[model samples]
Target: MCGLRKVTLREPYPDSRPKMRGTVTGGADAPVRACDVRFGSADRPQFRLKTIQESALAGAFGQTVLKQGIEIRDGQGRPMDGSSSPTVAALRAKCADGPAVFIAEDRDPNSKHTFVRQIFASYVEAEAERLDCEPLHFRMATRM
Candidate 1:
């Protein structure tokens, strides 16, 4: 378990003097001192999603629907085609109403699979279904 240690200043330093102007609110015996304290991280440290993954997630989804150029008359009274590219329909079909899926493919810098990929699908039936509104099987490559 992680815990913090109490710090106290025993006496005033040669250059620094205690300003004992007012009495202690709790009582006289209570120690009132200031000292520098440091804290470290606990065990089982969790990591954050890299910046590339985050950017790719938002950018990829945004670019998919925007490609069809077909206006969605639902929200904002304007076009709702905010998908980043054609792959948006396939992604939405696979995940259904489920959370977005982020797959990390480890590859060399020169290899093709060395990037973060995100796909959304709606798995309501037996297998993941691709939304049929448009054919969005395109991919948007994100730069490292």
Candidate 2:
């Protein structure tokens, strides 16, 4: 194997919090829409649940119309914002110049409901094309 422990199963972090996106700007002819994808389960389940939920959501919302990508970066394409999460920090350290989509899937232990919040960067279209997912319905959920 690649010595990589897949995050297939994870204990819900008690303090799991919602994430926010940074500033972004897209080129001409692009529609910026905020796509809020949320989900969660009551019982402790497998990681595939996330994938399943994502797939179903993509189906309902139409993947082609909802696919979105985001790249977390500092001003001037630098990595590591003062408010970046550990996931973001590690990503930057690994690939400084790489673009990253910061996805937050939050599961509430008591309610068993998960909230999937997606933050799309202004460059989501290009990135989504690279990933072959789909162009996202862009929106500003968090005010930067």
Candidate 3:
């Protein structure tokens, strides 16, 4: 099954200056806010997947937010194919409970290497806390 492996956060883009601690700027497409959270390095490149809409995540926890639901996407920025893979199925099942934080190996479709994506529902932050890792909050610039 494709699962998430431990990963270290990417360093800030060379062009932009670092903002508040754990915050960086100028890495993602305009309008989408992103923050890089550092994780431990692994043999493969690992990525953290989060929804662009914070409200959707807040709503998942029963908090009031403008958005109502979460949308999961693949590395290619497409809707996930849950039915075709056990990894996706497990991820989907975990997400059903609430907002989820996933740590996954970034894969190239053209490559033959296989990897897994790990899903954590609320538990991720707790795990991070246990590991003494601070979760980085990146505020992506919104497109007008």
Clashes of each: 23, 12, 14
The list of candidate 1 runs beyond 4 A from truth reads 1-94, 109-136, 142-144
When sorted by lDDT, best at the front, the candidate numbers are 3, 2, 1
Candidate 2 runs further than 4 Å off: 1-5, 12-79, 82-97, 107-144
The residue-by-residue lDDT of candidate 3 on 115-138, one tens digit each, is 221222232333333334334222
Highest TM-score scorer: 3
- Give per-residue CA lDDT, model 2, range 41-119, as digits (tens): 3243211111111232333432222233333344345433112221111111111222223233333343332222222
Which 10 consecutive residues of model 1 have the lowest summed lDDT?
A: 44-53
Q: Which residue runs of candidate 3 sit more than 4 Å off their true CA positions?
A: 1-48, 51-55, 58-98, 103-107, 117-144
lDDT of each: 0.24, 0.26, 0.27
Report how far residue 108 has shifted in candidate 1, in Å: 2.2
Q: Which ten residues in a row have the lowest lDDT in candidate 3?
A: 81-90
Candidate 3: count the clashes. Answer: 14
The candidate maximizing lDDT is 3
List TM-scores for all candidates, in order. 0.18, 0.20, 0.24
